[model samples]
Target: MKYDVAVIGAGPAGAMASKYAALNGAKTLLIEEHASIGSPVQCTGLISKAALTECEISEGSFVLAKMKGAFVYSPGGEELTIRGKDVKAYVIDRKLFDRELVGRSIDTGADLMLKTRFMGLHHGRISVLSSGERKDIHADIVIGADGIMGSVGRAAGLPRCKKFLSGIQFEAPYDACDAQFVEIFTGNKFAPGFFAWAVPFGRMARIGLAKNAGDRPALHYLEELIKHPVLASRYRGSRTEHVVGGIPLGAPERTVKDNVMLVGDAAGQVKPTSGGGVYMGAVCAKIAGEVAARAARKEMDIKEYEKKWRSAVGRELALGMIIHKSLGKLSDENLNEFISFLNRPGMSECITEYGDMDHPSVLLKEMLKGADKMRLVRLLGVAFKTLF
Candidate 1:
């Protein structure tokens, strides 16, 4: 089949990219390797409200729970509650969510092809094995919305994301203090570089962790996480539907090469602090699609895709990397001190007023307003130095 744009992958990123491309008047085709749109769910499904807006979909069957806040557990086991006055995020069923996104894309005039596996690129075209039959398609612009194992990226010889974290998770019946408050576990014992999370959905929660670059695997961390004093109390005596995956961080210097552009996990647009990609991926994918469509018309260079997307989110991603590195370097004692500082009389209120999942730097600036306090000064000095 021939098209102006071919988006390889039917995940949220690819769906949005194809939808935007079609909306911009490009004849777009979205291909999914899986028989179904969403299957073998790999995500924990905690998405910010802004993320939902970016995806342009209202609450649907995919939304399992809405969360208002998070209960953060410091290394010393001291709990601090970061509350939002309104709904902060949602816990979703990724399988249903992916289907919804693809449906919307199809509605926008993007053709859909299932059971299509992208093989590689040929001379100015793409090779795919569709439904057990091999074929070649010529396209003005190709988008690699595929996941971490993106064949399009390989075909284009794009560099990989800087690093990857091993992740493992399982759904289980949970006993939580508040249904709206997700639980965060932070300590070297549980996750050395990153943190563990229990995102609640009614009486059930998705418990998972992503391990930093280390010898230990993600499952090893999951094994240790379940035994945590907090998780051990809530987890029912059962295990089912476990997911193993990799979380990518720090995008490669280039996400666009020649006539191809990368979006979502394929581009490593995930936030290091949260290990979430849907929000940032959607933000970048729109630009990728628009650029791809415009480039197909010979109205813009494909490199415009690179420049525009980076100008939009490059700073935030860079800041997130700094925060991730700072937190990963902290000792148990340092974490205790940091949490203790936040537990002070006036601190939580400040966080509540300015905190945002999609923009932590906003909260950081607010926190720095009270930098007269030496502890806050020391911490901000270290983190702010990285940003500059």
Candidate 2:
């Protein structure tokens, strides 16, 4: 057992890359196969207070739902809200935000290892199994923020499958929630590639969905989006807590190779339109913990840690993988004419200042120039004929 860095996954991009590689002195470590770090609570913890002030994280450790805007239903139910100026988003409490990011990476000294379980990665070391023994851990650097079916990104071969979606959150005890707005239903009978949320959180509220397992099975599209019809007539006797998961969508051909490196959702950095990835996996795990502590003190050349985490979050996850392949070929009457052209008038404050998930394609090319450019070029020619 040796390490300069071996942050398999304690979420929040392996706890901010083992707390910035043990605050840059290295010798970090932060494994976890969940003996509880943010337990079985797969996402829906909406974010955006400029991504919790770029991971400095502390609005009194969240649970403060003050979103002043967002509502975009329409499967013929048409509706659109978008407002925002004061508070834009926040419904966290993801187990107290993953235990305050693994207690600030064990108070910045790193070294965790709950319930272990990494189990393989020969040459570069790392092969655990914990509790019942079978260890061996070495590293000059390794971080795969295990997630999205991540086994440290398939033991570092990268490509841990993509084009996923299948979500299904829950947390109810409602009575027509609107803790300041955050509903977003969308077409395809509720959820196709993505879209379906409630997210209140002050008095319980998280109802979710993400579908697209080639079209169904995200708990049967979250039980047909809570039996639609305006979300089953608002609450209709709430009481949930379920929460299933699986949400990737696109972008993860390679989040880095050789000496490893792959942050949040194991580098799918999720968001394509809005699947959210805890502020782009904690700002790409704080730029892969300052480029893995300068690739462990100038020993550099891990492809310059994937070109410095693709220059900090590869162009907003490659423009959210091209707006999640053009909103998965719209249709629901083209998402009710793109929600009536994003409810006109300054298009929802330029979609809340370009959904600033850290420069999401520069706010998606400025919300495609206030949209409606010939119906966004006929929805990018139906997203290039449905993703070719």
- Write down the TM-score for model 2: 0.35
lDDT of each: 0.89, 0.75
Sum up the clashes in candidate 2.
0
**Model 2 lDDT tens row, 111-191:** 898998888888878889988698999887788888887887787787764677777777885545467888888777668
lDDT of 1 by residue, 1-388 (tens): 7899999999899999999999999999998999998887899999999999999999999999999999999988999999999999999999999999989999999999899999988866889999999999998899999998878998999999998888889988889889999999988888887899999898888999887845777778888899988899988868667888998899988898888899999999998888999999999999998999999999989999889988998999999998887877776777787888898878999888998898888988888877446779796566456434
The residue-level lDDT of candidate 2 at 62 comes to 48
Cα TM-score per model = 0.97, 0.35
Error of 1 at 196 (Å): 0.1
Error of 2 at 182 (Å): 14
Runs of candidate 1 with Cα error greater than 4 angstroms are 371-373, 380-388
Q: Total clashing residue pairs per candidate? A: 0, 0
Q: What lDDT is reached at residue 163 by model 2?
A: 72
